[model samples]
Target: MTHEITDELQGIKVLVTGGAGFIGSNLCEFLLNNNAIVHCLDNFATGHRENISSFLNHPNFTLFTGDIRNLTDCKNAVSSMDYVLHQAALGSVPRSINDPITTNEVNVSGFLNMLTATRDEGVKRFVYAASSSTYGDSTTLPKEEDIIGKPLSPYAITKYVNELYANIFHKVYGVDTIGLRYFNVFGRKQDPNGAYAAVIPKFVKQLIDHQSPVINGDGSFSRDFTYIDNVIEMNVKAMLSIHPDAANNVYNVAYGERTTLIELLGILKEELAQYDTAIKDIEIQFGPERVGDVPHSLASIDKAKSLLGYAPVFDIKKGLQASVDWYWEHLK
Candidate 1:
């Protein structure tokens, strides 16, 4: 099994906030696949309803169409769950730059609601989604867990604030918290046509539709570009394990490898050219660098590997190929 959910999490009660988005939906599927009674809460602000439509009928699954920014909603959702996976938040650097207030409301205030709810509810473990953008201006090559710079965007500030709040909960309320700093995760069921869609799916969609995919900057900036399976592993490990030293810590969930934009476009073209050879001829356009964008990002997974026993399964090429195949089948 490419993503066999371990029995450690089986039979556990889980509340996955933002359960309709790319990573949240995948986590919901993995939990159900492993026999956990799962509850999903989403407001459909950035997440799509169609993403979890297939799981609506599962006996072990409960879908609550709600927002995390509301304390009552987060409190009601967290009351019965043994573990909480907080994945909901507004994403995208430019979107956050344009609308920092909404981003703050959703990502910052919304995170605090979840934190307060989970702590008060006496949940066994709380694992939330953090972002690599927390490494705002460090100029470091492969980001480590302990060392971090200031935030670059409003979105980044929200994610960094997640860590801060989690730490406070752990210290003040004795709520066990863990943060997975995800770096460029992409795979199946990702929304391709959204205003804030991620790069892999967005690029693949344009390439398939015979549209030029715009590369911001000179196409030389790079990222770790982790896959969904690896991210799922990190979450499961963080939730299921009972390591004394690992609690109240943050770890980067990413492939330890780096790939440039030009290399990524080449790979996307190579994969998509199989179905539509004309994709090979689709010219890639360049644009000036966007605000609040990092020039490069890579992760050092030693912390995750040693502590939570985290092991990532796919690299950029394999992950992008899987993404391309999935989008081709589902987006048609």
Candidate 2:
């Protein structure tokens, strides 16, 4: 999993805010593998300890039990870090809808705390996990960075606000920031049991249990499903990018392709059937379309490609196969 971009991380002090969660833990692992000094800050709200248990004893790895909402906690974790990967936001549109107040407290106020800490600490670069949900109701294909419609959910509004805060932080405080808008990332260690679990892992868990996975609509809704590896690569690139115009810019982190739910289910079943033949016979159930879900999603990765030299090594099929193998081996 080592890439040329990771070479810049050798000996660098990096802090991952939600290092016990899926994407955050993966980033911590990648940083450690590349010989970076990794410090993780997490409170275990939505994160699991087992995700980072294997790295707890690593010489360069340190874990700090803290929440992002606390300014002192953020400052303490970021004290000596050279780079900050801010991933400690409350995710899920449904969760935000159910509890918009908490979502705002964490995603907005907490993000401000982290950004302020990064600036005060003089971190060289701040890279945070922005979301594709920020695209909102924009009916454009191959979504470009600059154009976005009104946010359709509290979660989306929070993410969009993050971009605004990052831009303002750079202009006002002179903090170097890069925002990577991830598109439906899925991979190993992604929790499959939660109510807000991502579609790929949720459906994989259902199929593994011989339970019919339900589609939210007629299965026509599509998404630009990004792999965790691709996301890690982009994060590294953003952290290390020296392009004169790269700072304070947000880039789309995706494979630049889309797959509908029906098509996704078909591929998932085929991939799982290799281990369990019975999975192929399991049917899909259709339900009402989820509110706040866009009809389609696709990304124009040209900005990242040109500025950060991002080249995604895994497409949806390859990513799904890898995810299915992990889920079968670990969950089954």
**Stretches of model 1 off by over 4 angstroms after superposition:** none
Best candidate per TM-score, number?
2
In terms of TM-score, how similar is model 2 to the real structure? 0.99
TM-score of each: 0.98, 0.99
User: On residues 1-332, what C-alpha lDDT tens digit does candidate 2 reach at each position?
Assistant: 53654557789999999999999999999999889999999999999999999999999999999999999999999999999999998999999999999999999999999999999999999999999999898998889999999999999999999999999999999999999999999999999988899899999999999999999999999999999999999999899889998889999999999999999999999999999999999989999988888899999999999999999999999999999999999997
| lDDT per residue (tens digit) for residues 142-211 in model 1 | 8998788988999999899889999998999999999999999999988888778888889988888899
The models' CA-based lDDT, in order, is: 0.91, 0.94
Query: Best candidate, lDDT-wise?
Result: 2
CA RMSD of each candidate after superposition: 1.0, 0.9
Candidate 2 residues lying further than 4 Å off, grouped into runs, are 2-6
Q: In candidate 2, list every pair of residues with a backbone clash.
A: none
